[model samples]
Every structure is written in C-alpha cells, then in structure tokens.
Target: MEFHHLFSFYLTIITLTTISLFHSSKAVNPIILPIFKDTTKPQYYTTFLLGTPSLSVSLAIDLSSPWSWFTCNLVGFNDTWYSGVPNSSTYRVQRCTDDNSCAVYDSNYCYTCNSPNCKPKGNMCTGEIYPPSLYTGGSFYGGHLLAPLLLDIITVYKSNGPIPLGKRVYGFSFGCTGVDDLKGLSRYTKGVLSLARKDSNSFHGFITKAFKIPNKFALCLPSASKSTLNGAMYFGGGPYKLPPSKLDLSQFFVKTALVVNPIDVGETYGKRNSSIEYFVNIKSILVDDTPLKINSSLLVIDKNGLGGTKINPIYPYTTLHTNIYNALVDAFTTKAATMNITRVGQVSSFSACFSSKNMVGTKTGPKVPIISLKLDGRNEDIWRFYGFNSMIKVSNDVRCLAIVDGGLSVKASIVIGGKQMEDSLVEFDLESSKLRVMSSLLRFGTSCSQFRGA
Candidate 1:
C-alpha cells in the first residue's frame, strides 16, 4: 500500500504546563502523526522523521512491546527495503563498552558474542542488542541487532514551529537489525515505535526528561468507520491543551491507578517484568447499572504480575475470560431478546450477533447496553463504552459484539483492545501511576486542529 505524508509543519518551544515548578518553557509539542489503517490487517500506521535531514518513514504504533529499530545496510540487511540511513554528521552509535546503561542493552533478541553463530571478530562492542518480543494477539517478533545502537537528531514537526532537539540534542539509541531470522520489517512497516518503557535514552523516556513533564503520554484514535485517517498522540500534555470551546474537555476523563506489580518482580520491563505487560486492574464491569456476576478475583495481579486486563492497542478486539465472556454473552443476548433484535448466524468468533438486514442500512440499531469499567477500586472513577462502540458492523447485515473470549486461559483473563478505545483519549501515566480515559466529545476538530493552536 502507498504511504501518504499527512502532517507537515515546523515544531516550536511551548511553555511546559505539566512539568515541575523549577523549570519553565521547553521545546515541547505533541508530535502529531497521521494515522492510516491497513484494511486487510488489524493494525494502524503512523509516520515520523528519523534523522537530521529527516527521512520520513512509516512506523507501526505498538504499546505492548518495546525496542524500536529500522533495517540498516551496514548490518547486512541490504536485501531488505529499508528507509535508508539518515545521512547526517550528527548521527552516531551508542557503544556498549563506552556507555553503562544496561537498561538500553538488554533484549531477548540481543546479539552479543555469546549468541549462537554471532562471534565478534575483535573488540566490537556487545552492548548493542535487540530483544525478541512475543505479542499475545499479533505477530511474534524475533530478530537480532546487527550493529551498535544508533543515536541521532530525531525531529518532530508541530504547528508552532520546528522543535528540533535544541542544544540538548544528544540523540536516542535505536536498533539496527542485520540478521534475517524473523519476519521481515516490511511485513509490519518500515519500523515500529514500541511505546512501552525502555531506558532513559529511549524515545518516550528521553521526551519525558527533556521536556520536564510527567512520564505520561496520550493517544486519541478515531472510530474505524470514519473516512479520514485522523488521530493524535501526545508525548507530554502539550497537544492535549484544547482551545477555549463550549465543551468541558476535563469532563470526559476517567482516572484510575495502575495495578501494583509484586515487589520481587520489579518494573524492569524486558526481564522478569515481562508479565507486567500493560495490565490494568479491573474493579468490576457493569452492563448499564447491573454488575456482571463473574469472579472479581480474576482481576488480581498474579505472582508473575500477569493478572488483570491489559488495555492493549495491538489487539483489535477486547478479550475476556471464558467465565466472564459467557456472563456477558448471556446478559447481552437476554437484552437483545427483549429488544426484538433477531440473532443472526455468528459473525467472526463473537457469538452474540444480530441480522444486518434489520439494522445495517439504517443509522440506528437496537439499544446497546452501556458497558462501564470500575477502575482500581474506585467506584466513581468509571470508564464507560456506549452501545455504538460495543457492537460493530462486520458485514452489511451482521453486527457482532466487539468483545471476544480468551478461551480457557483464565490467567490471561481480559485484554481491553482498540475497539473499546476508539474516539477516546487514553493516557498511560507512568509517573503518576494512573491511567486516564477521555471521551471523544472533548476533541474539537478532525485532526486536533485546536490542539495545534489553530
């Protein structure tokens, strides 16, 4: 498929609103990325400028995994079609020996001298590594780092002006894959921006420190049916500052605490903390006002720190435990029976579906029950998904519940996916240890026009 450049503007320094009191204005703005969906694949793509004379390349937005890389010719990946190297004087590699940041060095697919068939000829640094990540619902990534981690001037364009890495631009370390054992980078995209935690020098880490903002980021993904490939992601709170309008932007937000990982497990990410993933504690789930009768213990974080539900963008549909799924299906089907919404043959794997002929052509469908999530033991802090989002029209005549069952893996209980998050601004606040969900009603324009200060 052809890639299109959706956003084109220079970045500028904006007064940091969410930073500590000591620091003031910083070169910060939400690097707005134009989102494009792959009709065939259940994924979305965005573009970013990687080097000095900025080479624009498409990147898949993945939150479950970390470690982002692009194919490099020097690493022996010449056969692959990679967005060529950023020919700039400022570009350099972060050597393992010279730097002591182990957080940046560790990866499951890390290529060291000890790795099989990877014998370093001489004094080559073994620090440069790439970790293989296995997604629960998508492609299983397995690959090695061909060369040392690279650091260069990564530029992001915004409305105010070009917010280049001013004087503090030491560049960030990214992977350069040389080996070809895993699926090709082209299969996904030119590269991936694994939005999960990495070292202090990684993309999101660097931005948090550089701008002196809380270690948090937010994304507003539009509905799938919307024709325009429009969405917004903010590194800091810079882009979330909507201009004065009639709508109270703050009214849309629902706040909750992060599930506490076991003390022994730690938040080290790639290592023992793999089980942490992006799991969030679910206090309860309610259909309309009535709560579902599933075991609440299923939401507790396990010893491996892998309990509760993960609000993962990688999975297109929300998944629930078999017990919880059955409860939901029964509740929904019972509700449908009262509304006279005839059950059609199953669409996809979702068991609860209605005949499309009755409601597909019409703008309205049977009343969909409101689904609400009570977060982190807070009864009032609820994130609700309306009827329109809970049911999706797969074919012209078949409308199915967007949620699916996780089969028998009771441990992998729930995964709140993209469909539930559409038209909502979801924030992963690492510093505050909270997750905030903002309804789409706060969005003022199609492309965050007000966020650009337009």
Candidate 2:
C-alpha cells in the first residue's frame, strides 16, 4: 500500500508548516522544482543541489527567513547533513569585515566583537539572532546560528537538466551552520532555505544579478490531499502575463501594489533589518460577493503601521483579528442559515463547524460560499477564495470553517495562509513591488508543468 500523507484533518490544520527559502539557480527562464508536502511529518520540502560536486538536499522553504543553512556534522538525529567539508577554495567562510557579509544581513554585524567569539577588536565571523516565529499550535520560538558567510555555486533542476548559478552568497555570514538549537522544527527538516530581500544577498537577488531577470518569484502550493508536486514555483518572472486579447484567466489575476511593513530597527544596530514577510493592505473581505460588515479601519494596517494583512505561506489556517474574526463568523453563519445544514460544534482550534444529512456521503458537503479579499483599497484588486479554500472537511459527516483567531498576541488583522493559497498561482514582483493572484490553472484546466508561463 502507498504511504498516504493523511492526518486528522482538524489537527493537521493547526500544525505548523514553516517555509524557508534556499538560494536557487538563475536562468533565462524560471527554474521549476517539485515541492514535497509530507502529511505524516506535517512538513513541506523541496530538493536542491549544493556544493562543487553538487549533492541533493531536501530543504524547507521559508521566505520570511534571511539565512540559508544546512546541518553539517550534526549528531543525534536520523538526518542527512553536509558531511565532512567542501573544497575551501570554492566554499569558504566570509569575514565580518567583508562588505558583502554585512550587506547580506545588516543584523549580522557583530558591533561589540571583531571576531567570531566577539573579541574586543578582532576580526571574525558575525553572529545573529532571529526574531521569534509563531507556529499556530500555541508556541513561539527563536533560533540563532554563528557562521562566516560564503559565496558558492548552487545548481537547480529544470526540465532540461542541471543548471548552476555561480558566486551566489549563502548569507547569515556562513557557508554551513554551526551547532545551534532549532526548537519546534519538523523532524524532516534537513536545512532552511531563504528567499530574503534583494539587498540582503537573497536568493532572488542572486537571480537578478545572474539571470538579469526581474527580482520576483511565483509559487502555487497544491492541496493537502496530493503528496506529489501538483503545485509549482517560478523564479525570474511571472508565470502568466498575457495581453488583453489573449486574456482568459489573465482577467481573474488581480495585481495590487505591495505594502511595506515598518520594522523597528534595533537601537544598537543603527540599520533596519528586513524579513520575508509579504505584507499588504487588505481593504476588505467579502463572502458571497457581499462586503463583510466590519470597521474599515480594522481592515486597514495595524496600529503599529504594519500592513493589516500578510500572505504567510507558513501559517496553515487563515488567522483573523478578534473583531474581524467575530464579524466573519457572524456573516458566514448567516450565509449557512439559508442552506439545510445545521451549525455543529467547534472542532479543535477551529471557530465554527456544520453538519448536513448528505454531508455523510463521500463527496457531499455544504454549499460553501465564496470569499474574496480586496487589496490596497481597490475594488478591482481583489483575490477570491473559493469554498474549498475557506472551509475544511473535518470528518465524514462534519465540515468546519478553517479560519482561526489571531488573538491578542497577533498584530496583523488577517493572515492569508496556505489553505487559501493552495491550487492558485501567486506572484510576488519585487521589481514593481506588486502581488498578482491568479486562478488560471483551474480556469484553463492545465497542469503547472504545462503552463508555459509568460
């Protein structure tokens, strides 16, 4: 029997799926790779080749992270690390004084010490600490790694063959990560890949320098049911950008100006460090084409001035602010009232549930409503979420609204998560600072590999 990647639909929804970016090869066109989601491990991974000889390492992709690190000579786990050492001539450590080192991560600057050990005035490798990252199961933790950054070759596989992008930096001031504590990490985690900002020696930045393509990337995460890479990711340029006459699914693809979330710079650093958070303003959300009845201000940016909504691939369920959450539940409940379904009790972390007589059947479920998001206050710039994206099938006879409450700890009003993003191609154009959402794959009924992106 095939090992099915199935879990209790309810518990799996709350499980954390942390995404980190790894540096990828740059070519004339976008390099395509298969993303593997393991339901047993509750993890997402993609394979990449690294080092001079090029070895395959399945790494977790995290866009919010700036560090690209893999375990080397790691002990006490049934895992694969980089093993021994690479040729120092090609994969070497970067000095703290190197301009490229500091340029990769401004926070990597070791102000107090001159060296790896933080000597009073010695030159050495820089150390950095990451901000606390949240996993929806009620926990937050931070990790740190100390290593000298290095510029090396990384090869990625496309339909043709292996292609290498040279002189690309492995930032966080290190070629290989040192002994560190990665708390709350998935057991299948071999390394962390980062698609950091352009100025930060990021993977996309390397693509821009090597391929001369726009500093942008697009990704589509497949549904949890499929274990294979039904989804796709494109670097270099958008997968879809056709003319008006050629427009089909292109019309459904909504593009909106990206919003920057202001981060507090440390008083000691004197430099603003950025993260991979795709922050954007959500003007409003609609269920069944009716705008939700909530305070417009609540739907705007946060009190701290960060964008009110962030499209986080790591978070599995869509988390909403308490006020906005209440409004959505009320509205969705009213919409369900019209159907013959009856409101069921809550399931695990979910807010609402429903049950119907026909729901016990294999394919029968509620007449799920359509949910849409208005971006940057533009009515035209809307991203719609269908019934499957907004709701979850908890049991054979029970289905639940997949939304979760962000609670008081969360700053953002809404977090558009993986559940809403599955089966849809979302592009993040760093050059134009815009986000494009499309349902073309479903509209055209084409596989990701066959898309022939423009």
Candidate 3:
C-alpha cells in the first residue's frame, strides 16, 4: 500500500469511530508476540502543541459638541436656584400647576419666578404688592432661556468657584459611524470657530464682529479608546494631546454624555458577520523524536471493494517528519540505535490493509485509532510490538500520544489488540504557567523478510 493511502485510511477510521473497547489479559498465547522484555526502556519523547485561543469580538464609542456662553450661564443659574432652598426646609415646593408654574411669596411679599413665562398674562399675573416694580415678571427670564443660557452659566459658575446652586448642568446625545466619526465631531469645534469668525454675515460672524474678537472658547465632547490614537487623543486632526483645560472635559462628558456602546453599534451596523474554520493532519509518527525508517506501501480500497497498491521505503522525513529535522532526529536516532538497523539496505517495508471505525474527537475520519505504528523488518518477532494488541498489553509504551484542548488538559486514547487500554491513554495539560511532553513509540525487527507482509 502507498504511504499516503495508509495515512489517509488511518485518519478516516479514527474520525468515524466513537465506541472504544477495553480488554486486559495476562495469558501468553501464539498471538502474544513480544520483541522486547525490558519494561524500563522509554519508548517515546514529548513535545507540546503551541497555539493561542481565539479572541471574541468587541466595539468602542466616541462623541463631541459646541461650547457657548449661554450653556455656562444656565449652569450657574441652576446652581443658585437649588442652593437657595435650605436643606432643613422639608416642605416640598409643590407648584400649583404640573409645570411648577405657581408663585412663591418671599420675606418682602415679593413673588418668585414660578410662572412659565414670568409675563403678567394669565396665571403668570401676580397681584402681590411688595417691591412694586420688582413684579415686572422678568424673574424667570433666565428659566425661559435655560437651554441656550447654559454656556454663560457654566462660565460664571466655574469662575467664582462652586455656587450654592450646585454645579452647572448640561446634556446632549448623538450617534456616529465609529470612533473616527466621534473624533471628527470632537475636533469640529476648531473648524466651526474658524468658519464663523471668517465670515461677516453669518450668525457666528455677527458675534465675532460685535465682540471685535474671535471666540476662543471651543466646546468638545470626550472620545473613548484614546489608546487607539497611539498615546495621543484624536479629534479633527490625525492625533493630538488635549490642552490642560480640556483634560477635565472628559470627566464631564463621561458623566453626562450618552454614548452608543460598541455591542449595540455592531448589531445596528452589521459589522459582526464573519467567521473562520481550521483543520490539522499528522503526516508522520515518531517515538522520542526518532523517525522509524519503514519500507512501507499504500493501498486504496473504495466502497466498491476495488483496491490498488503502491510501494516505497519510508525515509526519515519523506512525507512525514524528516530525520534531518531536529524535531524527529532524536526519535529516529533512538529507534535506529535500539533496532540495530544501521544501513538503509538492512530495512524492508511492508503494507497492511485493515479497516476500523473512525476515532471520535478526531476531525480527519471515523472509528480510527488515536495512534498507529509501522515497522520495517522481516522477523514477526521484531515487529510484534507494532501488532494489533501489543499496545494494550504494554503499559509504559502507551505514553506516546498527546491530546490537548483550549490550553487545558484532556484525556485521549487509542485502540490496540482489538481492546482499549487505560494505560495507553495520553494526557496533554500544558498551561502558560507550565509545560509537558508528548511522545509515541515504534518497534522494528532484524531480517528485512519479517516485514514483507505487514
């Protein structure tokens, strides 16, 4: 049989078989041929499978906005408003209307800005008579323009330190394609300022012209994933370090800003739609890093019962692990030294054709053995160790196989002599903190004729 055909067959049986059989016996019978009696000899060497586990998918978000005096001022007013009410004053300042549009009388019988518009129309008309002209109804003027007045409130509130009204308050929400877009928005303030100041007729131009100066105060929202910017914060420009004053901006933005989490963004944008698959095959087998030189052949048998065969001498690395390669050098050297097969002419290869169920947990095929051995020798006595039941009967020889999963340890076994052997099971338990070895064995006999029918 050709080597490829033999390897293919081996992979097929193991992948298709799930049921495993275990048998233990002490009887020395005709089929119980033994090549070596020394149990102290080690048969296989160990090596580890190196690879990292796959990473899960994830996402990130960024945001930005405009800074105006109106915003700062509104923040300041709200602070004062909240502070004016004493904590001991338990009475909930209930408004006569749902919108808190009821007036409150102060020490001098002066009415507060409880009305919606503060204009003397309808419910806003206060007939109270203290500080007469103070009833002009402009008390709640700041409340009327609350949203746009935030910029000014913030400016005053910060300049004079914490006001009794609490901290200035502001809020905003928006969406973008990804981190880049978010950064773009954050840096957009500079461009907006430049454009507004450059023109004479634009609204910004009116402010610039009236103030006789450009608005240096720029508003910006913080962005996430600053590391992606490579030690620099990315805004409108490629990358930039935020100014000292803007450093605290991130805190405010993080506190009150509403950003779309990465997971949600991925779902809405359809970015999480990719996957990958993998497959692995063992081309050659070695014991203790030694390559077993076998004069092996291949045989292909199809479901139709038709088969063909090919012959070839298995060299160290031909289709599998090469002898010259450091990986299999020790195994080949050890096997060759122990078998005493010095010359290439001393080895004769044979092919065996047997069908078994591919092995489970194996991706290649079904009812197959987890591990297999091939020998190139004439004396059935020498190759006896490679026979069907030899692996099950021998305890020390089974340590040649290794099974691994997710960097964790798992138990793996192979069928031998028509029965399964627990001692034949191999364990692969290499963690980043620790390492282990994986090895297998092969036995060869003297006289090339003994391997002719294998």
Per-prediction TM-score to the true structure, in the order listed: 0.75, 0.75, 0.13
Runs in model 1 with CA error above 4 Å?
1-31, 73-89, 98-133, 137-148, 158-170, 178-188, 198-202, 224-228, 238-248, 263-270, 273-276, 356-366, 440-454
lDDT tens string, model 1, 1-454?
A: 2323323222112211112111113424443444444444455555555565545555656664445565544322221223433455466644443224434455323223334333221122232233333344332232334444556665543334423232334555566554352332324355555676444434567666655656777776645423233455666642244434434354567888766455212223334434334567788888876788998877776765545777766567788878888998887777666666678778667788876454422222235666788887556788877655588878876788888887765445787877777656687878777788865433344222123211
Indicate the residue-level lDDT of 176 in model 3. Answer: 10
Candidate 2 vs candidate 3: which has greater TM-score?
A: 2
Candidate 3, superposed: residue stretches over 4 Å from native? 1-286, 289-331, 339-343, 346-454
Q: Please, what are the lDDT tens digits per residue for candidate 2 over residues 66-106?
A: 55555533311111122333443355444456444555354
Reference-based lDDT, each prediction: 0.54, 0.54, 0.17
Per-residue alpha-carbon lDDT of candidate 3 for residues 386-450, written as tens digits (9 for 90 to 100): 22221111122121211111111100011111011111111111111110111111111111011
Clashes of each: 10, 16, 77
Per-residue error at 52 for model 2, in Å? 2.8
RMSD of 3: 34.8
Residue 259 of model 2, lDDT score: 71
TM-score of 1: 0.75
Identify the runs in model 2 with alpha carbons over 4 angstroms from their true place.
1-27, 40-42, 74-89, 97-107, 110-124, 127-148, 158-182, 224-227, 239-251, 264-276, 356-366, 446-454
**Candidate 3 overall Cα lDDT vs. reference?**
0.17
